[model samples]
Target: MTALAATSTPSQDLPSLIERAASMLSGAKTAAEVLEAREVAGLAYDVAKRAARLQRAKSAHDDLVAAAHRAQAHALEIEARAKRRLADEYDAAQARGEVAGHGGGRNFKVANGNVETTTADLGLRRDQIHEARQLRDAEAVDPGIVRRTLDERLEHGEEPSRAALRKMVVDAAMRGMRPQRRASRRNPLYVAPTPEQAAWRHVTGVFRAFAEWASDENLALARKGMREAGDTPFHDLDARAIAQGSAAFTTIKEWFDAR
Candidate 1:
């Protein structure tokens, strides 16, 4: 049995081989037939075990891909926050006039033993701040290239440098910013009046008709009917008022119609 197992052809497609083996097992009758069925069943079992291992490996690879994307997104968020903080600090320093070294007009002792007053170059920090702001805006508008680059670096087990990330952001900006798609506008639900309340419109039309054609005594009777039905004399015709007035309207209309 060991010799036969060792000599059996390696299965290229495990699932197909397993199905064939199952068919063999289902039709076994004699001892020789049963032995052949058992051998096929054993092969199927081995193939199933191999398939499980392959599935696990595929799952692990998928998980790694997901982790890479998450890491990229988190890193970009951190970078954006740091740039914002730096810009804020730079603004505060400028406001306090503490960035004097950035502006011109300072005297320094030269290596040649001569005291020289030279204009200080104060715009370096400001330029850096401007570049940071531009990169941040570009990232906000279209982060696809930056995200892809960072994810690739993470997949390769390399830490992406700040310079590389900034370059990617700039490259994306050069490629033209992609405007974000507007979210689909949904009309808000129109809450219909309750059935009882909605019936009040018919009731009010009847009241208006009675005011024009009916006698004062009949109109007084209608008002009394409305009060009895829980409607205020000067109801605002809101949901509750409509609900209360529905019964009064029905009673007045029926009396007038009968007359």
Candidate 2:
């Protein structure tokens, strides 16, 4: 990460940060430089998102919010490009016998030459390489899906949330469809939801829906059914069962706490 990426506080200088990262990635002479540029781009995206949220909360001008979102979209493009670079470099490294891993991939064991840095030496994970390739291929197939998703949200008065995009990707993957690609546009940038992002949307969606369904009255009736015999087994929410605390409350609380 560079000094630009170290920006912990929200600043309007996200454009500069993104520009620097793009320059670094384009001019990168080494894999490390690509990684650094990606890191900065990631930071730029995060900071711009926060700024957009802050502006919305303060009821600032709509233009300000839209500009921040545009910054985020651009930053994502740079990050995707970096991923492509890293993927290509990893392939080249494998050919040069510069990548050492536990299992053979693309090639059999080339006698370990202690002469140069390996994939492990540079702290590159096999998973990252695969994910980078996925992003690159996704762009080839779908064109400007990454930026278009964000810009669409801005135009539609949505929050421009990354979670929403991840959810779309997961859903698309489930249905064996490419994610939200239009034939009219094309661009080099792309993103595919990681397992972590997919899992997040899954867990949060489950919790949200469950919380609404498991209201006090509903739980109370279910409790009655599980408890005493023909005691109507149903009642309205007087807040009685919830206020006094019951087996159903304890069970739900425990499950929620575990989560």
Candidate 3:
């Protein structure tokens, strides 16, 4: 459905190409299609990255420039799957002794880990492969983290750079020395949330379920009657529960009023 599936070059119009990248990802219905979508997205990210570098010189409005950076961030996020797939394929090849591990990283079959097909033979540098491995490892922990951090930086009016992203990843890794995660958290990268971010996240997370529960049909169901165990509805409103909920709401109202 797209011409860029086989090519790396993207259209000159950054916004239009961003749309295409998004469309490719959404339209993908098969594994092969998904891989192709990653390719297109990677191309979009590359194009947007370059275009954004000149946005200041072009004197674009702040919003427009930020939007472009965000598009780049989104595209890079989509391309993460491609990074994992590439690294996995390389690792499998290394396991099979078809290629050496980049920079002598790992290889089960080959002792020296040197093989016939070099990364150079495949037209990739050691550093590129190493970066791919890093992306793969990080994504395995928390998908879309790179894009999220990039967008976070842009939202704060900071220049988004590879160094910044690397620092974030490294910082998160360093925080690994913290105590083990609670059962609820299962800490992915150990990146701590700011106080404000944590508060907002807690509010949204709680309200999302509360909103669904307060929907019209649910509210009616809650008031209808006690549901039978086997032959009736699963959930029935209890007087004690309702009282607790009312008390909770009042407490929240008071807290907000105090604020």
Candidate 4:
């Protein structure tokens, strides 16, 4: 209460002495005003506590946001894995013939009833859009138009094979050389003819069949030839061995031509 010692004038003491004295005074005053100062300091401490808690909460929120992003990335990875697995399963199932059409040739209808196809399996998105245009245009024509147009276009061609001509004459009699007329013709007897006549007859029958088939525009001739080559008498013959045995007489054509 000595007027707080004139509050110590700045010029009254040396700088070091003044600093030391100021520290001693502050310590002494804090002890004397302990309760009052404690209340005020407590308020500041409370403010710091709240600020620290707010900082911690902000940090925790940032961590949660980061975790959410990581979870989202994981979900995308899982989705990609599922898509690849489904694609592989689809390919395996197709190989085993569980689905219809050529093994890898058709569009896929997914489990969700959505149509999706790989670029390799069918058209890409852009290609599908283009093909859709063709389909839309074709749908405008009659269903039978393509076949009818082809038949009419080939009507004047030379008569092809029996199997072929039959296709061309879609509505006509099944057999040509009318049945009654063929019956009256002189029939060749089973008795052996000259070798020249025998070979000629066989050759004539083959040529006639080929001509008729070609004229009729029958598309199955190549398949029929391959099928016949694999069956019965022709397949059993050692065509390969025969070719290897003689160089000058090599190959099916050479063997037949040499004879």
lDDT of 2 by residue, 1-259 (tens): 5544465545546666777777788788777778888888888788888888999999999867876776777777788788878877776776666554442333322224334544554556777787676665454445555556766876687666657556545554565544343332455465555657755564555457567879999889877854542231112211333464466556657878999
Residue pairs with clashing backbones, model 3: none
Compose the digit string of candidate 4's lDDT tens values, residues 1-259.
2222433433332222222332333343322222222222223223333433554567756433332222222222222222223334444545655444343455444333355544354322433333222222221222222223334433433211223323433323232311121233455443445657645565555446546776434657655744654642223222443354344324534657889
Q: Which residue window of length 10 is worst by lDDT in model 4?
A: 136-145
Sort every candidate by TM-score, greatest first. Answer: 2, 3, 1, 4
Cα-lDDT of candidate 1:
0.47
Candidate 1 TM-score, true structure as reference: 0.26
User: Which 10-residue window in model 2 sums to the lowest lDDT?
Assistant: 229-238
TM-score of 3: 0.49
Which residue pairs clash within candidate 4? 160-212, 160-213, 161-212, 161-213
When 2 and 4 are scored with TM-score, the better candidate is 2
Model 4 misplaced regions, further than 4 Å: 1-61, 97-105, 109-259
Question: What pairs collide in candidate 2?
Answer: none
Query: What ranking of all candidate models by lDDT puts the best one first?
Result: 2, 3, 1, 4
Highest lDDT: give the candidate number: 2
TM-score of 4: 0.18
lDDT of 2: 0.64
Candidate 1, residues 28-147: lDDT per residue as tens digits?
432233334445544544444444356456775643433333333333433443454334444454455544445323332222335332323212344656665565456445433455
How well is each residue in 140-162 modelled by candidate 3, as lDDT tens digits? 44544676688688769766665
Provide the lDDT at 69 for model 1: 33
lDDT of 3 at 219: 74
Alpha carbon lDDT at 115, candidate 1: 38
